[model samples]
Target: MSTMDKGTGATMRQTAKARRRQAILDHAKRLFAASGFRAVSIEEIGAGAGISGPAVYRHFGSKEDILAELLVGISEYLHAGGAEIAGIGGGSEGAGGSEDAGASVGVGESAGVGAEAREGDPAGVLRRLVDFHLAFALGEPELIRIQDRDLSALPAEARSSLRRLQRQYVSLWVAALRRHAPGLSEEAATVTIHAVFGMVNSTPYVVRRIDTAVVAERLRTAALATLGVADVVAYRK
Candidate 1:
């Protein structure tokens, strides 16, 4: 094959591999959410993903590896997303802003705030964080359920890494909250952030019963309220 054709073929294979890996993760997440992690086997996950049990090993080392990737991958995603929303760089807590940070953190920009104001405004940041989290909670309730019940199923090193990433994500909220409420203590901010997370993460149970849009709005209002912000109406869709 020509060089260009060879490159195209390699890219296609990589894309297919990624899709298969994601399918396995998706199936494993749902199964683990329904049944406990220890109760779910690789054979079941592979079957759910429409592959033979041994085919799973081509994507992951074992069942525990799949669980580790699911949990750690989401944690990393959250950490990176929080950093982006907060206009910070990489995994560090340093001061830097993304080029599109304003757009990313403007979930409530409809309130007539300019991009400049939305970029690092504490209220805008908090509102944006709420909206960002609501998207994940509503769309991936299976991951939330799995994390809630099966986090301990991960190996010790993976669990520690997940917790560290989680702490960093929480710190973003704490920073934003303290910026909005100057008098708030670090302990208070951390506690309030966790409370909002618990409330938002509870969507897996109620999503089937209520309209997702309504559930999102209500959670947004309650989350802002928990942060002592009174202007949820401005952020309403």
Candidate 2:
């Protein structure tokens, strides 16, 4: 048998260790979402991922490790994705990176213009961030649920680190919103951002009643209105 190493977190590695470890993480997420993190056991996680029982420990020390990786993985993924979206080097540092997260990837007004040009308009910037976040909300509902409910189950330092990244993400939106609406005080912008997040995060509940498309549109319009951006309007045919 090939020796098992936990391997670094890179999912693209061509080693079986990397592949099986990723499989464990994937299954863990599905199981954790279906059954709370506390209810699910490592043995079950192994079974779900097609790993033989008792072998799951080789890749992860304990269930808490898996949960920690899951939380950090998503945060880093968002930071990486936000960096990619904003046209920064992958090695770029910080939760928001040097460039704006609202910027689009492979998109620019001209070569070398980068995120600065991509995010030229304030409303456009807010729209891009809203669109990115909404996509995150709609596509990863389970992860969202886990983030909302299971976050506290992790250790305090880990949880605080994850939250600091989240605050940085929020600050990008607040800055962009304030830029678009210069009249808004920092406190007002912060409050509005929280209010819109409250509305957007109620997706699992609100989406049950209306078509997701409809709810998304309403949320987008309402978000712009909350920021007091001019020209906010309903979807026009």
Candidate 3:
């Protein structure tokens, strides 16, 4: 066979291998999300993907590796999304901008402000942080569940790294709260942010077992309530 033919064949083989790897990961994610990490098996993942059990091993060394990939994927997503929201300009249209400057504002009200103003308005920045988190959790329920359930299965170092990434995400929100409500101590804001996160992250599991509309309404209500609480707390003290 010609050298060119051999090279083309090799490229095709590589492409096919990558596709298979992705397929395995996708199927594994679905299974892990549907059933906690402990309940899912390599064989089940492979069967769902129309591949043999050993084929999964070829792509990921073990179930833990698959879980690692899923968590890493989520971490990357949150990092990128947070950066994007932080980069928005004050004049930008859509969800990231101010409707009017003269309106009454809460201590942490600036948390929801656009990326451009994130540096200037703590409350706006905090608002944006919450929005970014809720957007991700509400949009990717399966990924969230998988991450929450399988996080402990990851190695210590990997777990630490994931925890660091999560903390960094939360820091952005805390900073905004500090700015908007200068009276509140750092410890207070930290606890409040954690509480708000719990409310936001719980929506996925709730949605799975109930009607979609009900889930949607609950998510909205929860978000608004959290924001309202943040606003009240920021200004109250």
Candidate 4:
């Protein structure tokens, strides 16, 4: 066979492999979210992904491996994305190369925050952070369900890594909140941040009942209000 032919074949094979791997992850995420992780098996996941049960092992070591990728992957995405919007390096240098998690890849800007947001500006950081989070909360509620219900199912190392990334992500918001509302004690800010997370992450429960755009606006408003930021208005889509 010609070298060009071989190269094209190799590229096609890799593309197919990549698609299959993503299919497994997507199906596994849905199954794990719909039924708790422990109750779902590799066979079930493979079936959902349109492959035979044993074919899954070619892509992942075990069910827990897939779970780790889903959980840890999103965590990494969130951390890296937040780090970018906040205009700083990630919280820690680690085995994965950076801190992070997430689904949608862009930062949304609220009308109140304006379009000329510069990096390192506190209000700009906070506005982008809020929109960044809202995008995830609304776009990937299933991951939230898996996180809430199945985190303990992860291997110890994976669990620790996920938690570490989460803490780092939260710290980004805490810093922004305190920077804007300097009157808030650290404890108060921490508590409020968790509250906002709980409120936004509750999308899994309530998202189906409302228009997603409306939900995004309300959540943005409530989050900013809870954090007591008066300068940024709730962004309307």
Best by TM-score: 4
Candidate 4 achieves a global lDDT of 0.76
Query: Which RMSD values do the candidates have, in order?
Result: 5.5, 6.8, 10.0, 4.1
- Sort order, lDDT high to low: 4, 1, 2, 3
Clash count, one per candidate: 0, 0, 17, 10
Could you tell me which residue pairs clash in candidate 4? Answer: 74-101, 75-100, 75-101, 76-100, 76-101, 77-101, 78-101, 79-100, 79-101, 80-100
Higher-lDDT candidate among 2 and 3? 2
Name model 2 segments beyond 4 Å from true.
Answer: 1-15, 80-119, 205-210, 230-236
Instruction: Compose the digit string of candidate 4's lDDT tens values, residues 1-237.
Output: 999999999999998997888889889988988999999999999998789999999999999999998888877777766766665554334524332223221122221222323534566667677777778788788888899999999999999988998898898788777877788888898999899999988963576787887888788888777877653453332
Candidate 3 backbone overlaps, count: 17
Better of 1 and 3 by TM-score: 1
Q: Each candidate's TM vs. the true structure?
A: 0.84, 0.74, 0.71, 0.86
Q: What is the C-alpha lDDT profile of model 3 across 98-163, one tens digit per residue? A: 222101110112223264453575545555566566656666677777777778889776687668
Q: Which candidate is the best by lDDT?
A: 4
Query: What is the C-alpha lDDT profile of model 1 across 52-119, one tens digit per residue?
Result: 99999999988988888777766666666666676664742321222222122222111122242346
Point out the higher-scoring one by lDDT: 1 or 4.
Answer: 4
lDDT of 1: 0.75
What local lDDT does model 2 show for residue 182?
87
